[model samples]
Target: MAAEQTSSVVLVAVDDTVLAQLVQAATTDALADEVTPPLTAGRAWTADRVAWLREFHRVRRAGLAGPTGEATWAVVVDELIVGSVRLKHTDEHGVLDMGIWLTRGARGRGVGRTATAAALRQAASLGASGVRADTTVTNTGAMAVLRRLGFHLTLSDDGQDVRALLLLDPEGTAACEVTSEPS
Candidate 1:
């Protein structure tokens, strides 16, 4: 997949050179608190950053062709890197999982929504039948963005996380429905 541009943000496919910058971005307080659980365990100092990048590379090369069946991208706005988003293939055929994180400065500005919309389009082009995502229940911002993008709440687990799904039609008329189920 190639980089995609939105009205307010750009999704640049992750590459080896951007790994270091992404590691640094992940260390930011907002990102650590909102998205990356592993990084929240401790401050992502130099060594920790290096280790994270190393593992990220070892597990999956930085591109659409990565071994992990995931496509990760660096989210940029105004030429500054703000966060990252990922789309991963699931065990269920034609289904993909989407994840995203934005820095403190980028939150509540429609960056995530725009970037995600672009990603969903990319996924549809890649033949995805549906896309799903999970967000912490407390993360109202994320939930709102997903809802606005046509993702319907499908499940709520332990009052901690909520799962949402958006079914895509090849003809481009996707329908979203919201449901609530105990995890």
Candidate 2:
């Protein structure tokens, strides 16, 4: 259960300093535990952390990418950023990939869902026909949110890992001519 805190939230872009700080803080915390061993998969947190910081800068610099293009937004609650979402169109593939993150204190409190929904709406507004996202099978929390967002599961393997895809296009034209479910 999440903390019983009441907050009126707003969605803003990544250019805002406060939102950037919040994203960095949340991302650092998320990498803290998974920074080490078995989950590391022979990787280094120092490097990954640096990469994340760079990404933070880029996301911040993205500012307003307009309605039909990639955009980053932060979920602000009570004037504080608790989460963020990134939605962009992969022109090569003609599909939009949506990404989201929520602070530790904000998790399990519906922040992710709210932010993701906002991102979805933005994607639709961007002239995108559909939106899609993926997460490791172990990410049950994210999976739950994605499922509720009407994502269709296309594939899964026995490694307790899975990949999920969603379609946000009502007319099914923005993504592709495939008006059916993903394989």
Among the numbered candidates, top lDDT falls to 1
Please list the Cα RMSD from the true structure of every candidate, rounded to 1 decimal place.
7.5, 7.4
Q: What are the lDDT scores of the predictions, listed in order?
A: 0.71, 0.61
What TM-score number comes out for model 1? Answer: 0.78
Q: Mark the 10 consecutive residues where model 1 has the least summed lDDT.
A: 174-183
User: Candidate 2 on 4-67: residue-level lDDT in tens?
Assistant: 5555556776664754575466556555343222343444456565456446545544433644
How many times do residue backbones clash in model 2? 3
Model 1 global lDDT (CA atoms, 0 to 1)? 0.71
For residues 46-87, write the lDDT of model 1, one tens digit per residue: 555557654654465544456788877788877777887778
